[model samples]
Target: METVSLTINGKKIVTEKGKRVLWAALENGIFIPHLCAIEENPLPFGSCRLCFVEIEGKKEPVASCTEEVTDGMIVDTRTESVLRLVRMAFKLIMSRHPIICRECPANKKCALQDISREMGFKLKPKRLPQILPDLPVDDSHSLFTYNPNLCVLCGLCVYICNEIVKEAILDFNFRGFITKVGTFKNRPLAESKCNSCLKCVEACPVGALSRK
Candidate 1:
């Protein structure tokens, strides 16, 4: 495999050719906040919009998850502009996500919590008014629960279900702000004929899916 030389946050590194900046940074112990990155997936979804990084010569920051690492590339993961963008992205995700870490299953293990801690951002958004979703929790599955209100719509579960697990049992049910992960015809998990693999639950970044 060919290797590419690059500098991330002023640290010189070499990664496999064709690797994305997000994975390269992560593999080298450099953290770029992200949630919607699955390295095996051919195309990064970039739904979370949390992995913004500034590359030399670029006018605007680019999502590290979707940006392929190149030889001689210089990546800055902590630029002022990059932090501003990442902070806003975190805030936007928090605007809809309920802050219930004390009561939530994910709690300290949650991706949002990790991002908040790593980025020095608060869990609650100060600028945007919280628009809490009133969706009921789905405990129909014998092994797990689905809480749409706590969901960040990172799409990891959906991608894992359809692409990795090949279950095709879950997907985004609606459009826009009302969108959520759901079974076919909006059926309950018990009626969806899910095989109980629980990969989706395991892949979920937030506690939207959790063991019962």
Candidate 2:
């Protein structure tokens, strides 16, 4: 494994080459908020924008969860502008998300819930439209149910399903805003040979997939 030297939060740290900025920051005792990246899982699902960081030589802020570290890299984990952007991103995520945290099974434990609280969004934004389309629910599976309306297109479900489970049961079905993760035939998740593993449900950071 190749090692790279990088500065995170003004602290010099060394990490292996190809290691993501998130890991490097973590290894250096610098915590950057994140939702989709997990230790047991190396796949960087940068759907949650909480991990945005400013690099000295980078043109734009990059998602730390996906951007790999390089030698002599300078990373800023906290800044006024970066904090503002993160707060805005958090607000946007919370706006479209259902206010089920109080009653959600994952309530206190949910990544989205924790991040929302950390960002100090005391009141939900009113700008986001509440017109959520009713998607067909799939409850035939024993382990979990599929709720498309709550999905944030994080892609963790598809990533875990395909990469970890080695089962290509879920994928994007359309393009742009219409894009949805679903079974290959567009059939209900229950009908697919999903094995009822519930890995997708575990990997999802939002209420999109859950065990009811």
lDDT of 1 by residue, 55-132 (tens): 999999999998999999999999999999999999998998889889999988999999888889999999789998
lDDT of 2 by residue, 1-212 (tens): 77989888889898889888988887777868787676555767667788999999777788888888899999997777778778877777666566766766666666766665666554365566554445666667778877776777778888888888999999988775556778986888778888878888988877778897
Best TM-score among the predictions, by candidate number: 1
For every candidate in turn, the CA RMSD to the true structure comes to 0.9, 2.8
Lowest-lDDT window of 10 residues in candidate 1? Answer: 40-49
Pairs of residues clashing in candidate 1: none
Instruction: Please give the lDDT score for candidate 1.
Output: 0.91
Cα deviation in Å at residue 4, candidate 1?
0.9
TM per candidate comes to 0.97, 0.83
TM-score of model number 1 = 0.97
